[model samples]
Target: MRILVLSDLHANVTALDAVLEAAQGRWEQSVCLGDVVGYGPDPNEVTARLRKLGTQTIRGNHDKAVAGVMPTDDFNPVAKAAVDWTRAQLTPEHLSWLAALPPGPLATDGIVLVHGAFQDEDEYVFTPAQALDGLLDSTAEVTFFGHTHHQGGFSYQDSRLEVLQIHPRPTESFAALRIEAPRRYLLNPGSIGQPRDGDPRAAFAIADLDHQTVEFWRVSYDISSVQERMRQARLPEPLVQRLMLGR
Candidate 1:
């Protein structure tokens, strides 16, 4: 079965919609790596849509803060503001769902799902040293992570760890990675709501472990519209600006 892999949705329903529409009919099951709600306009709508899809999900740092499961003390001023705003905007039902979301390193559907590193859900795995723990310790050969918001992966086999260049180009729809048996992988699907890999397009992935290939995808969405909504909601200007910049 082809599995839809999504992460760092960050409450941008428009971007999520564009991804779903673009990926429709190509996936059999769906899983979200985390941050279902955080720094965008449609917290409730995104949560409700995921609920309706029955996607297997895990919570991110922002989700934890918004749900009151974690503190915003570590958050920067801008992130703290977004967290406060998201907490206020989330519905009781959505808040409960968000609160109850399990921390990752969750094993399901033949693959592992993690918001960040396998050892620490809140930690960012951006380098080989940071990624080595998860690559070595994960139960599954192919484990997926988010939070860095960059679409790439790390692989290990013969005492060597290699970072995989797996992102699709701006002109391409998707990039394919062939998963090998002896080698294990720690991959990121990038961010859907707010990409930070210098690509403005919404990012996601489709995994077909049975076929031993995963497709990293980038799809264009209505960013101007989403930015407008963020402005109307009085969200932080920096957040609004970064969406378009994909910083």
Candidate 2:
């Protein structure tokens, strides 16, 4: 079974569409780690498209805030501002869907999915120690996650843990990892809308379960459209500008 892993859509229809187009007929299913809204211009369109795709998506922090289930006060000034703006842009139905989404680490056959760390969906698992701690806590043999907006994964061999940190480069090749038996693994596919790893490209991952291999992927999208949308919506200019720098 091939599973196309995605996360942090962040309301960019362009990136989502590019990922989908790139994976057309290549995977049997697509799974999203969440953040379907916030920071981008097309919240409704993105949500509607994901719903139409029948993708299994979880509730991200931004999604929770928009649903009114999460407090925006804890967010930074710009993030708080963006969340406040996003909340107003969503329809009642969209709000309901966002509210209805399940928080993860949700496990399925050969894969575990989460919007953030298993300890807390809103927590950051950015460092090797943090990722190792999360891997120690989870029972899943292989876990896929997002939230730091960085493309990385951790592996445990015998009793040792190793971290894979991917840097963005054109024509980059993915590392193929093998899952033996039922050991623990935690993987991040990176961000789709707001990449924070100093790369201005869309990030994702692909898992071919049948072959027991997983690979990371990144692609460039029309960032200008998202910036324009932010302008039209009057979201924080810095939030919009940051997308270009992938900060």
Best lDDT among the predictions, by candidate number: 1
Q: Residue 183's C-alpha lDDT in candidate 2?
A: 61
Off by over 4 Å in 1: none
The estimated TM-scores of all candidates read 0.99, 0.94
Model 1 residue 217 CA deviation (Å) reads 0.2
Q: Which residue pairs collide, candidate 1? A: none
User: Clashes in candidate 2: how many?
Assistant: 0
Off by over 4 Å in 2: 173-175, 180-183
CA-lDDT, candidates in order: 0.95, 0.83
Over 65-146, each residue of candidate 2 has an lDDT whose tens digit, in order, gives 8788988888898888878887888889988998999999787665778888788899988777788766777766778888
Worst ten in a row by lDDT for model 1 = 162-171
Native-referenced Cα lDDT, model 2: 0.83
